[model samples]
Target: MSSATVDTPEGGFEFIVHDDHHHDDGEHHHETGTMLGFWIYLMSDCLIFGILFAIYAVVGQNYAAGPAPVDLFELDKIAWATAWLLLSSITYGFSVIKMHENNKNMMMFWLLVTGIFGAAFLYLSVEEFMHLWHIGAGPGASAFLSAFWFLVGTHGVHVACGALWLVVLLVQVQIHGLTHENKRRILCLSLFWHFLDLIWIGVFSFVYLTGVLL
Candidate 1:
């Protein structure tokens, strides 16, 4: 029996072929690497937040002749902002479900709803900051206010970024439908949105609620 042969650098040799299964394995590895990298990034972010929280804990009571949390923090407003953010997480979850179902329209609608809720959260947060500024409670006024603004403002910025990301993803979904790449993107966004919600819960409990009590 004759067999196929190929030329090597030095001589001819029998050709050896492998199945295409390794290609699928390589792709799976790539996907896992992507998720792992994102997770590592999130952990670094947690460290940043942890340091901020530690700083706040150290100087959160230094009023420097300024208003304290009791005077400046509004529970009602915080509650509303929390509700909006939490609801946005829920809507994002729905969007992910719709994506899994391959229902592009429903996914887009849920993403829009999530964005609106995120916007509401950011608006409420900005309003609270503005009210503080108008009342002479700006970050420069005291260490406590500075820490408060830095921590809360950082979270607000993240939400704003997430909202923008959602908009871009929505446009991509419209243009490309829910391709495998898009689904992966949506899943990553879902992780990020839920992570924010978890962080906000911590903010509400540790910052807002605890501040009011203190």
Candidate 2:
């Protein structure tokens, strides 16, 4: 009689069946490890933002050029900007659900929508900055302006980065299908996208709205 040995990649035992049965230990451990590593990386990123936010809070009101946030920001435009980011986050949620279902086209479509909305938000935000700059309230004008620039610019940079990442992930998904690694990448990107939305909500209420109305 001859014996058959199964490979586990790291050189280990695998279950073999006499019938036409297939069994492989799912890469659940690898998936879990990837998720944990992603979370740790995200938390470390969060700490860096936490410091920036604290600095903004401390020096956020120093408007040396006589142009306060209320004077420079327009609520209607800010509202539209907020809607854009919120929509992008919702679209990304759809993408993740579709990814879980292994519906590649649906996932890609939703991700495209997400990226479009994200880009729109960035466009609107840049327009808003331009509007402010035209009114003589650019970054160098005041500490208040500087803080605003620092905070809002930080978030915009993040959005741009996220959009770029979505492009990369879209390509990866196209190449790999809904693989374990690809799925983990999607999961991490989803988290990053939603986290940006959460922070933008803070930016809207505390930064834009308060600066405008209060």
Per-prediction TM-score = 0.86, 0.83
Q: Model 1 segments beyond 4 Å from truth?
A: 1-30
Worst 10 residues of 2 by lDDT: 11-20
- Clash pairs for candidate 1: none
Residue 114: error of model 1 in Å? 0.6
| Residue pairs in candidate 2 whose N, alpha carbon or C atoms collide under 3 angstroms | 62-144
Query: How far off is residue 72 in model 1, in Å?
Result: 0.7
Quote the positional error of residue 112 for candidate 1 in Å.
0.8
| lDDT (CA) per prediction | 0.81, 0.78
Q: Give the TM-score of candidate 1.
A: 0.86
